[model samples]
Structures are given as structure tokens and as C-alpha cells.
Target: MRRILYAIAGTLSLITGLIGVVLPVLPTTPFLLLSAWCFARSNKRLHAWLINHKYFGPAINDWEKHKGIKASNKKRAYVLIVLSFSISIYVVPLTWVKVLLLFMCIALLWNMKRIKTL
Candidate 1:
């Protein structure tokens, strides 16, 4: 039962991670990390595959080893942050809400920037 649950979680995380590649609203690294964790619990083969994957393996391994993001990923994240803020500024009408959102955005950006990205 636990294995089955892990398998399901792994599959969902992988699907979400794939979708995140094209959709800026969905994050890629978090889902990939989730998938890796699930696979580790469910199947050794899958865990190995994810950790050794060509396109994503390096980022995942770096994150696992150092809790860091890659430089390219950091750049992409900054772009997304700007885009999201622009959208929120236009779409949200309430000044207080917008301010709150902006604060949250700044906090997240700061946190991401502080992480050791290579």
C-alpha cells in the first residue's frame, strides 16, 4: 500500500514536472524533486533513473547534495517572477492585496536568490 501510494505520487509529480516545462505557472524543480523522493520510496529502478536522467539529473543531484538551484534555473525563475508580478499588478484591483502579493513575491525572490545556485 505504501509502495502503491509512492508510485502514484511519483507518476503525478513526473506529469506535473513535464507540464511545468511549458507552463510558467507550474514549477518544474519542486515537482521533479517530489518525483525523485516518491520514486526512492517506491522503486529503486525509478529512483536511479530519475537521479541519473540526462536533462534533469544534474539539477536534481545538485539540489539533493547542496539544496541549490542552477544558474540557468535562477535566470528562468527571475523571468517568471517578473511576469507573475506584472500579471498580478494588472489583474488584481485591491491595493492592499496587491501590496501583500508584492511583498510575498519579494520574499520568495530573496529566498531563491540566497540559495546557492550554480
Candidate 2:
């Protein structure tokens, strides 16, 4: 049952990671990290695959080793957050919700910026 749950979580994390690749509003690293954690628990094969993955592996390894994002990735994340927040402010119906989201976005951006990225 624990393995099954971990597998399910890994699957969901992978899906979310894919979505993050296409949709700038969502984040890739967190999902990939979650996938790695789940894979580590559930399947050695999957854990190896994730750590060996071409696009994601380097970032994951960097994060695991140094708790840092690449500079390019950090810039991209900032841009995405700005664009997504602007879109959400215009599209969302509730002003309060938009403000809350804006606050959250700023907080996340600030946190990301504080992290030492290479």
C-alpha cells in the first residue's frame, strides 16, 4: 500500500512536471523534486531514470547538492511569475483573490531570488 501510494504520487508529480514545462505559470523543480522523492521510495528504476533524465537531472542534482537553481532558470521563473500574475489579475473575477495571488507570487519570487543560483 505504501508503494502504491508512492507510485501514484510519483505519477502525479511527473504529470505536473510535464505541465510545468509547457505552462510557465506552474513550477517544474518542485514537482520534479516530489517525483524524485516518490520514486526513491517506490522504485529504484524510476529513481534512476529521474536522476539520469537529460533535461531535469542536472537541475535536480544541483538542487539536491547545493539547494540552488541555475541563473537562467531563475530568470525564466521570474518572467513566468510576472506574466502569470498579470494574466490572473485581469482574468480572475475576485479582486481579493487576485491580490492574494499577487502577494503569494511576490513572496515566492522573493524567496527564489534569495536562493544562491549559478
Candidate 3:
């Protein structure tokens, strides 16, 4: 029962990670790490495959060892965050939601700055 739950969670995380690849507003690293953890608990084969994955594996390893994201990735993130927040703010009619989005943007920018650049 627990294993099934973990497998489901892992699958969901993997799907989110894949989406993050194209959607700059979504961060991929944390979701991929969560996927790795869930896979390890539920399925050994999947855990091994994820950690050994070519492109993602290295980024996972780098994050595990160095707690870092590439400078290029960070640059792109800055651009996307601004673009996304700007568009959303303009489209949303509610003042409270716009304020919340502004706060979220500030928090995200703070987090990105704090992360070590590789």
C-alpha cells in the first residue's frame, strides 16, 4: 500500500519535472529530486534508472554534491519569472491575487539569488 503510493507520487513528480523542462516558471530540480526519493522508496529499478539518467542524472548529482544550479539556467529563470509574473498580473482581475503573485515573485527571486551558481 505504501509502495503503491510512493510509485504514484514518483510518477507524478516525473511528469511535473518533464513539464518544467519547457515551462521556465516551473523549477525542475526540486521535482526531479523528489521523484528520485519517491522512486527509491517504491521501485528500485526506477530509482536506479533516474539516478543513472544521462542529462538529469548529472544535474541531480551536481545538486546533491554542490547545492548549485548552472548560471545559464539561473539567467533564463530570471527572464521567465519576470515574463510570467508580468503577464499573469495583467490578465488577473483580482487585486489580492495580483498582490499574492507579486509576493511570490519576490520570494522566488530571493530563492534564486540564494542558490549557489555553478
Against the true structure, candidate 1 reaches a TM-score of 0.82
Q: Write the per-residue lDDT of candidate 3 for residues 1-118, one digit (tens) a residue.
A: 9999999999999999989989866878789998988998999899888888987897776676788988887898788888999998889999999999999999989999999999
The positional error of residue 32 in candidate 1, measured at the CA in angstroms, is 0.7
Q: Please give, for residues 10-109, the per-residue lDDT of candidate 1 as tens digits.
A: 9999999999989876788889999998999999898899999999899889988888888988998888987888798779999998989889889979
Native-referenced Cα lDDT, model 2: 0.89
Clashes in each model (backbone N, CA, C under 3 Å)? 0, 0, 0
- The digit string of per-residue lDDT tens for model 2 on 1-118 reads 9998999999899999999988877778899999998998999899889989999999888887888889998898888888888888889999899899889889988998899987
lDDT of each: 0.89, 0.89, 0.88
- The candidate, 1 or 2, that scores higher on TM-score is 2
Candidates in order, TM-scores: namely: 0.82, 0.85, 0.77
| Model 1 ranges with Cα > 4 A deviation | none
Provide the lDDT at 115 for model 2.
Answer: 93
C-alpha displacement of 106 in model 1, angstroms?
Answer: 1.0
Which lDDT value does model 2 have at 93? 99
Candidate number with the higher lDDT (1 or 3): 1
**Model 2 error, position 63 (Å):** 1.0
List the candidates ranked by TM-score, beginning with the highest: 2, 1, 3
